[model samples]
Target: MEPLALLWDGILAATDPAIFACTILGAVIGLLIGALPGLGPTAGVAIMLPVAAGFGGVAAIACLGGVYYGSMFGGAITSILLGIPGDAPSVMTVIDGYPMAQKGEAGRALGTSVFASFVGGFLGIAGLVALSVPVSRYALAFGPTEMTAMMCFALSLLSVLGGRNAFKGFTALALGLWLGMVGLDPISGLPRYTGGSMNLFDGLDFSIIAVGLFGLTAIFTSLEVNVDKPVAKYTFASLLPRVSDAVQTRWQLLQGSVVGFFVGVLPGVGASAATMISYALAKRLSPTPEKYGTGIVEGVAAPEAANNSASYGSMIPLFTLGIPGSATTAVMMGGLIMVGLQPGPLLFTENPEFVWSVFGSFAIGNLALVFLTLLLTPLLAAALFVPTAYLYPIVIAVIVYGVFAIDASTFNVTLTILAGGAGIILARLDYPAVPLILGLVLGPLLERNIRRTLIQSQGDLLVFVERPIALGLFIATVFVLLIPLFLKLTGRKKIAADEAEV
Candidate 1:
């Protein structure tokens, strides 16, 4: 089927009552979750995993998709109203969003955010619709050798770009790789890390790890931080944004969306980075860069657009290459896998209906956010004031129930608790957990492909260099690895020059 026709069918299917209801339900839940100070999109998606999985099929993905983008929209509410970022990406939103609120233009600032988020998310979904097919088609040519190199390249990017400390990132990646190896050995048909237990045969479930690492870890951190709830100062004057504001920031919207989507498509880079880069670019291109932090609409618009668009952008790799660029997507990937769907190039050809239906749901969901944000911003803003003491217990209950519901196993619940403890330790030590999750997700794929390629070449390692695509990807991997060193050298040189001048 043609992409557009498939898309039309998807659009028709997404409007089904069950799918539509799930989208709205997920969006509402996500909005509340995102407005809460500590539970960001990653936790929001992670906590909802078992529920979404239970829904299954198009309904499942639709719910997850709604949560993903809805949280992006909701993140702005806390930042604008409370002067506290709801999530890492929303950190940029706080620079101007809160200031705008302080100046009594809270409605305008939120309107701009909504407008910008809508534009960014729309463009991102458009890109996803247009590019996913071609990317999948291109990726379809991947053999075992290319697949190995591709996975290696992805892991390398995660270690390098996933965190500030390469060593910590690599350490997390190694841990995840170890976790991925816990199941039976494909080659030897023997148990590896099971410790002589029957439960160890199938290894750890993805939902268990995701809920522990992101969902439970977030709750633990939130309780320790003990963030105070702040009351919103103003009722919204108007949910509708002023035309002049949108007109003035139109270029910023486009710039942010474009920059955000491309940055998001890269493995490891995330919405937070996309927003930062877009904000920097917007400021640099502005006539008055100094006005950025002073409650300017441009400031709010740029990052809002970038962050929402980046959320959509991250989906490309997840759907096409089976690589999730961020923690949220990693969990979503697990959801897809849990529902018996394998996300990869073959998905396009094999499951065109599912793919395009998801694309349609994204479009519908993005559109739904604008209405949801406008109507619910005031209510969601109030939710920010809900005490953490009340919220944490509910979140914990949900996590426990969700994990247990997966297979009705107390053992899985035990694993979740253990993983959560490990998550707390990793968090306290400042290790980036994203690489760990990605490693767990990609490790088996990498190992299987590596073995398959070696077997094909009769154990010759040189085949990696022999294939053009594999060699290119390897070279890219090397280049990515050297980026931190290059930055360090440049920083030292700049410091030396400053010292010399001093």
Candidate 2:
């Protein structure tokens, strides 16, 4: 069956009042979390991850997905109402959104954000519905060789494109790869680096690792430079915009939505990058490029649409390929595993019901997000009033509680703290943790697939290249590796040519 048909079937199953209510609750919770200055969607979902254990798989995931979209909507509130961005993705919104607010057009700015968010989200879902089917269907033919090559291609893209310093990204990835190799070997069922500790049998709990890397990292980072927001008076009247505003940004929304969806689908090109790139594209293409940072609705619409669409884009790989395109989805893989489910091509063939139900949740949550953001925009602005003194402590406490609550072990809590310290150190060194996390998630799969392929070929080293899909993916991996060198050489040549001309 087609992806849309499967999604439609899930929507039918998800229509139960219980699931719908969970979706609403999730959206509300997400909004509150997102409204807070630093607690973006990842933290919102991570802090609430323990509840996934109780809510059951479908309902809990429904809620998490709701929070994902709701937080995107909520992030704009602070960026427009206060000069401070709610999170990284909202940073671009502040450039144009705050200026609009300063000019007494706060409601319009907020309205544009909400409008673009809806459009972008719709386009992204449409992209998911359209693209995921073919990819999943095609992947059903994948053997161990193709799977290994694909994962290698994915890691290369993530390490090379996910951060500014590719070497640092690879270093973090190497750390994760080594860590992944600690447990009993997937092939031999024998321990390699257990250090004789039984706890090493399962290796690291990724959820604990995720919470530490993102949740604890956020909390620890907040301690150093928490800022207080000044009180501001604003009316909700302008949250409803005239039709003219929508009409003006219609093409911009379309452009941003397309850019956001495709940019978002690629692993490691996250929401922040999508928004910034979309904003730049809008500015460069605009006849009124000079008007971008001066508070134009187009500026607000472009990045808001792109980021929200990017959020939707991130979900696609997680559901279809068991590949997380961003950090939040990487964490979400743990949630899926907790439910005794794994994401991938088999999910579609074996667990069609679960797949469709999750799809339905995405639809319901996004629809609710638009309505909830519109109705509660004024109330949510109050989230900014939270003092850093109170908020930071509460967040720290919540991080500890969340880790322990889900893990139910003091050892996990200690590990979380240790992981947080590591994350902080990595951050200080300008190394990204996303690639590390991706490596951790993909490492085991890469190892398992390679072993399977090798065993099938009786240890033939030429097996990887013998397969066409694997060969193509390996070529792509080589290209990704060479990109930096190619760019460097191009830069040197450009400089030399310029010097000669001068």
Candidate 3:
């Protein structure tokens, strides 16, 4: 009853004219951004952070949240029409979607994609609402020791599972940790690695780093790559899917939502992975597996559903544990802090209205996207034909203006440029940047708690091992770290067995 009452309050709050307008506006902007190739939700959220943070309320959060999920819906547009994936998760969509477009079934393919996305988003948000409150309530009992262990577990999981190469992931994390340590010591008033610069006194803002690494780096990289624009081919008659198709694919959509949401709740296992897993599962279960990737509606529906659900699934850890489950959430977490709100268990207790309102706004945004995507699909598709050259200047100007507006500091602008350069270099080297962002975001929190615990225990290290919750968490961290090793050994044994059989 209490949860229901709180949820109703949230629904009411989101319906406010101002908040509703922002939510719809954000959904529209996010769709356009997502439809553009090479700029997924991660960059989209980071690029919008500075502007949204300034609004600083449920409206800001609503807008950013809209962008986060709205992009998931938008990615399907390019995949179905152009044979080019607008984002990573949408890559799977291109396999069947492009084929369908060639068959003159583009409208059906797109309608199926949008429907799947709406259903997936609905299920994911429902899961979030159901899980977040109880999980946060449970987290409230954590002490400094337990909190420290939890952070360690989250970081380890991200470093180990977040990329193709664990070593490269850890290297990125090290860079982030170094950056995290640059500010004044959390305990001591004296600066540690500020290099005697007054600008470094406040530490590097995650929002600034996010804008440079995600937003600016994307711009610089896009300018070097050339993309061919394909005209959209579809008729108004088939724009909306047949009811029979929806009925037939209903079970697969449900399967995708379930798989995506659960996978997304785990730290570092992102939506791209969820789509792959869901698509594979669908193929395995299908009687006509051979039909996959041959312009089938089920092929397009499964991955589309999974990616959208996974987006919501990733938010659980971000909201309840103050840990981001994916890169986009990490940027959103930074934006939350910039607006004077801290995400964690305490946030629920401290500001129930704000938390619920944000959740409510997600529901509203998800619904709004359905109409927006349907009505504007033709127009947005045409906009995609515009040359990339014309867009680069506008993106650059937005990035520059957003960063400079943060604190009006020329020094921060310099830092942003440096980070963008480093980001480009890192991208070329195949180094994963998500862990770096996670490390930077989680480092200070880990440090603060560890210091507080040490001070409380008079520098006794056993306090970490003595606490049962902390001990359990550390053990989980070790298990997580050994997963890659286990997989490597398993692969070697399988190869040897195959040779013996031959």
lDDT of 2 by residue, 1-502 (tens): 5667777877887888878888888898888777777668887777667665458868878888887778888888888888777778889999899999888888889889988988898889888888777788888899889989988988888899888988998998898888878888876789878889887788988877877787777767755544465534556677876589899998889999999988888888889999999999999999989998999999999999998899888887888888888878887787888778988888878887887797788887887787799898777776555666787777668667767776578888898888888988998999988888888888888898988998899999999998898999999999999998899899999999999999
Clashing pairs in 1: none
Which parts of model 1 have CA positions greater than 4 angstroms off? 224-230, 492-502
Q: What does the lDDT read for residue 468 in candidate 1?
A: 99
Which of the predicted structures, 2 or 3, would earn the higher TM-score when compared with the native? 3
lDDT of 1 at 221: 82
Arranged by lDDT with the best first, the candidates are 1, 3, 2
Clashes of each: 0, 1, 0
Ten contiguous residues minimizing lDDT sum, candidate 2: 224-233
**Model 1 Cα lDDT, one tens digit per residue, 94-162:** 999988888888888889999999999989988888889899999999999998888889889999999
Q: 129 in model 1: Cα distance from truth in Å?
A: 0.6
lDDT of each: 0.89, 0.83, 0.89
Candidate 2's clash total is: 1
lDDT (Cα, tens digit) per residue for candidate 3, span 1-502: 6766776788889999988988988898889878888888988888888888877889898989988898999999999999888888999999899899999899999999999999999999888888999999999999889999999998888899889998898899888878888778877788978889888888988988998898888777766544565655888768786798799899789999999999999898899999999999999999999999999999998999999999999988998889898899999999789878899999999988999998889998998898899998998888787777787788778877888898798877888888889899999999999999998999899889999999999999999999999999999999998988899999999999999999
Off by over 4 Å in 2: 1-5, 229-232, 494-502
List TM-score per model, in order.
Answer: 0.97, 0.95, 0.97
